[model samples]
Target: MKEIPKKNGFTTPPGYFEGLSERVLNKLEEKDTSALPSKEGFKIPEGYFDGLEEKIQDKTLQRETKVFTLKPFRPFLYAAAAIAVLVVLIIGLEKNNTSTPTFDDLAQAEITQYIESRDLELSSYELAEVLPVSELEIGDFMESSVDQDEILDYLEDSIDDLDELNIETHEEYQ
Candidate 1:
């Protein structure tokens, strides 16, 4: 297939550009001579500029603003800011300290639940090692319902030989 040649689609009058610059100049001259005023309408009053600087200075001096200096109170402001920061720090520290839970604050059931969930195998001797043994008294043990007979029965059933019990005397313990 043959490709057709492309042509511009725009057109103008035969003499449009013949005297374009002259026509524009003539129009500009007509507008300048007839449409626009010869001089601007603004007019200055007589002697207005003579004392203008003095009038401006008088007005400025009459409207003089009060100047404040922070130099006098700067130290007081710094001290107040420091005190505020210290108060906030002390209050924050107090709140944080109170937020921590203590051992005595824990419920017995909660402790038991935690131990059972972890499946800990802590023995009585291991528990005793952590206990405050110095606070215990003979009367504390005597408060138990178990009598001597029951204790002897338990020992007799559990032990096979007397030598197996490495019982210590008070003097030996001392």
Candidate 2:
């Protein structure tokens, strides 16, 4: 039981395949055609050929009495189940979504939910990789409403806070 044997036990003598064709051909050549069975050991039932028409008529002429049974509406049941799954999926996809949240009404909880739900297409890190919002050139806003003097005055007022924050300033490269 411990040591399993690898041998198959069945083996052929040496030169088995070498003369196989010649041996088979010799046996076939030695066969006596006259000694072969004439009826091939088969027999037809008595009166089988004589009553062929009657037997065929008995099967063909009679009504089959089919009850028009369905296999318990199995295919239709599967189709209905599939349609129900599709309907549920469609309804769920439709109802799960909501309208965009308005900025004025937007709270910290809504922002957190939006982030957690992955509703925002890009994260803040991805947005930073694109043009930073500060570097954007908005010609419409710059030409009309923006006042350089007012901006300078605001910056002068909060110069102390800017220094306190230790923010790095960009050096002009010319």
Candidate 3:
């Protein structure tokens, strides 16, 4: 298939560029020089500038003689500043007084729910950092529920794993 050649689709007004400079010069020549006034046509009083310095000094003295006073809203500005300080103090104290939630503070149901939610992504060491176990704190764990015999039995069973870890660590150091 043969493609048609496309035109630019633009056109100029007749005589737009022709004799533009001559037309502009003729317009300039048409203005009359004599009819237009050259002077600014302003006149000053004879002694006006003579006491200008004294007049300015007199105005300055008038202003200086008046006493300066506070604006009507100045007290309100002080009140707002005081209120802002009070609000900051209140917020600061509230944050300071709030206690950190310990294991003892959490309910069994909430603790179970939190555990079941699978939200904790921590390793055992990281979880230990979060929940440090003191003797008293450990007593509170499992609702003070597990028997002493069961605890001893579990510890005895885990002692083998602990011994293996110690031997591995000793070999690594040597």
Candidate 4:
């Protein structure tokens, strides 16, 4: 084939066309040669290649993939640890507590001593039958009764018969 000179923007050298045909025959190949100047040799007019085009490209709305990573459940772990520690501390405190004497213990001794010391006065009548421990309740029962003298008299007369009566020793006689 006769070689033809290239013209206009779609032009290539006759040898370059021949090379392209050869490349087609061999396999598909890209045409790297352009009718325009190479990028390295390209020079723009003053202020021609400003950042405006880049700014426009950036402003163009487009979908972007965003990845979000959630933080670990460390706070919950700390809270659970605190709760467990609190529970353990509460249990330890409970276990370490010693048995303390209640009001019942204190009142029991006082009541027993009072009764034994004045058994002769108290046993005369069936005072225990009328006023039992279950009826007396847990507090000061004698503090509210209106017949204190009658109660004392009954106790004295009842216990006077007993040989253990030490009423004379309790008197302040000279």
Highest lDDT model number:
1
* Model 2 lDDT tens row, 34-149: 78666668778897899799889988896868788765746888899999999999999888766655775876467657777986688678856863468456662355675656
Alpha carbon lDDT of each predicted model: 0.78, 0.72, 0.75, 0.66
Between the candidate structures 1 and 3, which one is better when assessed by TM-score? 1
lDDT at 25 for candidate 3?
A: 84
Model 1 whole-model lDDT (C-alpha atoms) = 0.78
Two-way lDDT contest, 1 vs 3, winner: 1
What TM-score would you give candidate 2 relative to the actual structure? 0.23
Give lDDT tens digits, candidate 4, residues 29-80. Answer: 3544465465667666887678879878888968597978789667889999
Best-fitting candidate, measured by TM-score? Answer: 1
RMSD of 1: 16.2
Off by over 4 Å in 2: 1-4, 46-174
Q: Model 1: per-residue lDDT, tens digit, 1-174?
A: 988768768889899999999999998987757676878999988999998999898887867579987656468888999999999999999888977788879975787688779866899898689756897676665647776567656776898864577754244322
**Alpha-carbon runs more than 4 Å astray in model 1:** 1-24, 62-174
Rank the candidate models, highest lDDT first: 1, 3, 2, 4
Per-candidate alpha-carbon RMSD to the true structure: 16.2, 15.8, 16.2, 27.8
Error of 4 at 28 (Å): 78
Rank by TM-score, descending?
1, 3, 2, 4
Clashing pairs in 1: none
User: TM-score for every candidate vs. truth?
Assistant: 0.28, 0.23, 0.24, 0.22
